[model samples]
Target chain A: MDTTSTHGASPGAARAALLVLADGRFPAGGHAHSGGAEAAVKAGRIREATDLAAFCRGRLHTSGLTSAALAAAAAAGADPLALDEAADARTPSPALRATARKLGRQLMRAARAAWPCDALDALAAARPRGAHQPVVLGVTARAAGLGPEDAAHCVAYESVGGPATAVVRLLGLDPFEATAVLARLAPELDQVARRAAEAGRRALTEGPGTLPAASAPLLDITAQAHAAWPVRLFAS
Target chain B: MHLDHSHDTTTAVSADAARPDGTRRALRIGLGGPVGSGKTATVAALCRALRDTFSIAVVTNDIYTREDAEFLLRNAVLPPERIQAVETGACPHTAIRDDISANLEAVEDLEDAVGPLDLILVESGGDNLTATFSKGLVDAQVFVIDVAGGDDIPRKGGPGVTTADLLVVNKTDLAPYVGSDLGRMARDAQDQRGELPVAFTSLTSGEGVKPVADWVRARLAAWSA
Candidate 1:
């Protein structure tokens, strides 16, 4: 699965652009969050590398796929406001909703500075409190001259990558082992991204209703519970 | 729904001279130091000392919990609305130095919520000697180290020790017990920092936090002028 096929005429330059956007060190405030891993760790669900892999795999199929589809739709030039409402409909927990919007606002600040697009400006103006993060991610990808598939990959990777890094700190799981878990899941990540992009392409014809609606109940419940915590590590 | 163009349309990215409405934003000063160096205590003292003259707010970057924020709140240093706690996800330095998106959001949110403020103190979680505030996050920074941590900290200068706008050597009251040499530490700091300022303090003393508070007032005056 060669995911790094440069989209533009200048293949090398386009490839480099993808690298910059997708790099974990992009400094978009993803480091402070554990993508539900912190909750799982607190619950004693993830103890070692294997448990982490299983947890990540489950999240990848659910929240990961959903975020990927929304991102792909945004990259394909869908309406961000409509997608934002769709995001709200999917996210049941108020805490998760707040987290999504907060992260979205922070991401918008960084993206606007990097890409400097009128569309992003318009979106930022439209949702001053911030839109859903996946919607913003897709729009940012579009601003960077990337396509739906690239946006899908970006969200999908972040789905597992965030948890992996966080689990390293939370559980002291071997960094090598956590990274290996991601490496092992690369093939599945590719599949999820492709399906998300396909769904995104369909969204233009049908509507945002065509996008995937996958949810993990435990994750949602735990996220709400975690927000009430007086003391916790990750923000979400 | 269009955002109030006057409030939200800030075009300048880095720590700008003015808010989007073209009014001068509050002067932001960051306090960073090693663990147990009394950065929070200093912040509390500063708030108690300067709140009468300035509309003050605080943002604390804590690694795990909201301990620092809770400390200020419990002490009643400022009203609850004037305080914000940012979670750094165990990477204290990242929030202050490397990727400052979270800290920027906190500061801006505080300003938007409590407008027309005069000063905002951004307190970093206790970190290593290398941690310093990014120019984008704060206009100036103070590095705090205590004699108990080691009088040798100044001699082994890192970015925070050598480059901060103000370096505070705290807990001079414990110098004798800790076998720390205040004079030698000052000399080493001078040798390392060449014209930057340093202050020795013991929070228990009446005038302990006075120098740092006065320094902040001077910065605020300069910022206003």
Candidate 2:
């Protein structure tokens, strides 16, 4: 549970690297995904800002927490291959798994170019098709010299940020409102990231199974349905 | 050329002339334009014209549907496996210009699947004049605008019209019916592009794609050289 150990060797430049990795426009193939927002919007689960906020909150606590912990574990120097398997075990839907791998492969390409590291290369060779995206993201953070907390924060933010951005496109919800939804979730994001980082620290000694495995069944169910849509805006 | 010091890694970076295996990658050319400006038609026509001479693959960034990839597939200009479609979320420009990771993946995957390719055509979903491919994504780009879209488009001179390696004024056959001034369009394009080339074509007419195909051949030649 000692999270500070992960940050001991991180340079001050790691902070800027975190910003670069967490930027919405980081070019890691996230734009095409809706984080289940599309399925929720189409099913009438999310109509306006309030519904969107609720959907994001639900996602944040479940899949977001799980993914953040996996990422944090990877960033804290957990075996990426093992963390990838743990991610697959936590993700129930095959469609989501495929999406994660596809995005992971894309991110691997970008990460290798941006920050060349042997760990990233080893994981890439092991899972050329891709490891899960959170696993890849954690390794990417490490390659960029970031800490486990930074990795956790990136995944936590992306969990809500991806859908909020997509909702602006799907429902034509006011961009300001969508952004404000994210702003409102910031404190919760911090808590989740902190918890995820703590779990990641524990996993270094306890094994990857110690990481969070929160599940949002609805998201898993809707993602499969979303993948089958012949005509949809987002890939996931 | 951008150099990578980590040359031992297997990952492919954007616009690298050589592949990870030390072979030359395909010459990637991007086509971008506004909605219904015949970008897909140009791609299909180019595939038909150049497939005999070169190993060609197409990557279509469809904004919503896979219509562009389907069009090429339906036309049978190239085999189905040679074409890859990328969903652009909602913003076609962002996929092409702002963030090109997906497109680059599609391009690299195509090369891996059907490689030793000579040319790879990346067609952007129809977008506004501001849309253009990033330099990191394509070696060159062709911006297609038609006579029907309005003769004034060239005069407007956005990044696509002004800065693309080539400007294609499509649908010349419709000029008479649409009451567009081809001469003025050409002049405006020349004025905007300086010494850069512009091709006028009507895919409905015989050998309409020849001029564009010839331009592509010259580019391919330069690339090979």
Residues A45-120 of candidate 2: C-alpha lDDT, one tens digit per residue: 9999999999999999999999999999988888899999999999999999999999998899888878877777
lDDT of 1 at A136: 94
The top-ranked prediction according to TM-score is 1
Off by over 4 Å in 2: A1-13, B1-7
User: For candidate 2, lDDT tens digit of each residue in B67-165?
Assistant: 888888998999999999998888889888887988998888888888879999999999999998999899999999999999999999999999999
Against the native complex, each candidate's DockQ, computed on alpha carbons, is: 0.59, 0.49
Worst lDDT window (10 residues) for model 1 chain A?
A1-10
- Global lDDT of model 2: 0.90
Clashing pairs in 2: none
Residue A179, model 2: lDDT of: 94
